[model samples]
Target: MNIYAIIETGGKQLRVESGRFYDIRHFASLKSQNLSSNTKILIYRVLLICNEATISLGQPWLKNAIIKGRILHSHLENKITVYKMNSKKKTRCKFGHRQNSTRFVVDSISLNGKEL
Candidate 1:
């Protein structure tokens, strides 16, 4: 099935298609400007048509749309870790890391029980 959809993820909206991967941190997408006026933009992936709906507009989920995808690998992010220790008394500290990422492609987008 193929169709259009507007998926909100990572505090953003994406008009994505199938067989693609996109970075969510960059803000906005290929057709729209970033909602944050102070943020930069990057098109990490391409959105292919996955539905019968026109490329004009649609609901967040394309009105009964099914967007499928795969884990086309993971995003590249800086490794972050922190740790601290104290002597004598007995104290300690620690930290962790996170690899920012975006959403995968819509392997298939279906609307109204139909694939376009």
Candidate 2:
């Protein structure tokens, strides 16, 4: 049976599964702490969990649900360019931005302190 959960981070919701790599917005906690690869992370904002036969849903978030993962790396995403032009005024502006992101591997999902 496969187990997966929906987790919220960096103002976004993501569907995460065990033994997989996912890239999400950079975590502020990681920035505060000097962490390297394989550092364990516990995510507590889980919205739902499914284990093939049974499903558990939370009212906003499950109280005892947690998702465990390990940080692999932190990097910046591709650059996005924004351009503004004024018609007949001969004025133009352009800027590029790259978003910070982190890559991690999901290790397990636990509910009520028990791994699923």
Candidate 3:
């Protein structure tokens, strides 16, 4: 049976599956942990878990539910360009920005100490 879960991290809720890589917002808590490549991360804010036969939902977070992942890297996203122009006054402004993000691969999803 295929298993998947929804987890909250970095102010976003993401639907993830095992053995998949996802790019998410950079986590400030991870910065203090000295995360390197292949570092394991435990996410406790799991909202839902689904299998082919059944589903479990949490009011806010599931007790004893965890999502395991490995950090791959942290990098910036593609540049976004912003431009402002004013007619007659001959004024223009242009800027670009890139958002910082982290890439990780989901290892497993477990509920109540049992792997799904």
Candidate 4:
């Protein structure tokens, strides 16, 4: 049976799948010359594993609800523009920035959405 589950990371929830690259959070700055060094990593812990049939819809939880994923790359994102302006005041400033993040994929989701 096909399995799909929701997992949380970096103050966000991600819908993941196997062999599919996704963006994640990277707290550290990347300064390496290699292109791969700038990417953020996203990895999941095997907390719980379960199947849809085993999920407790009304109850607290099933016997074992698993969540799992893995970090792939830590990379930079597109630069965003920041602008400040006043209607009549002679004050203006502009800046651009790129956020950092790691990539990950849902390897496999079993009963608890963890690897088999």
Once model 4 is optimally superposed onto the true structure by TM-score, how far is the C-alpha of residue 116 displaced, in angstroms?
5.6
lDDT tens string, model 3, 15-109? 99999999987764688355678888999999999977789999989899999889998788999999999999999999999997889999999
Model 3 CA lDDT for position 88: 94
lDDT of 1: 0.49
- Per residue, candidate 2 scores C-alpha lDDT tens digits across 38-107 of 7899899899999888899999999999999999987889999999999999999999999977889999
Q: List the residue pairs that clash in candidate 3.
A: none
* Pairwise TM-score winner, candidates 1 and 2: 2
Collision pairs in model 2: none
**Structure candidate 1, residue pairs in collision:** 1-115, 2-50, 2-51, 2-116, 3-50, 3-51, 68-107
Candidate 1 local lDDT, 24-81, one digit each (tens): 6433342232242223232323233343556633432334445555433335477788
Give residue 112's lDDT in candidate 2 (0 to 100): 95
Q: Is candidate 1 or candidate 2 better by lDDT?
A: 2
- Ranked candidates (TM-score, high to low): 3, 2, 4, 1
Cα miss at 15, model 4 (Å)? 1.5
Q: Model 4, stretches more than 4 Å misplaced?
A: 27-64, 112-116
lDDT for predicted candidate 4 compared with the true structure: 0.51
Whole-model lDDT, model 3: 0.88
Candidate 4, residue 26: Cα displacement in angstroms equals: 3.7
Least well predicted 10-residue stretch by lDDT in candidate 3: 26-35
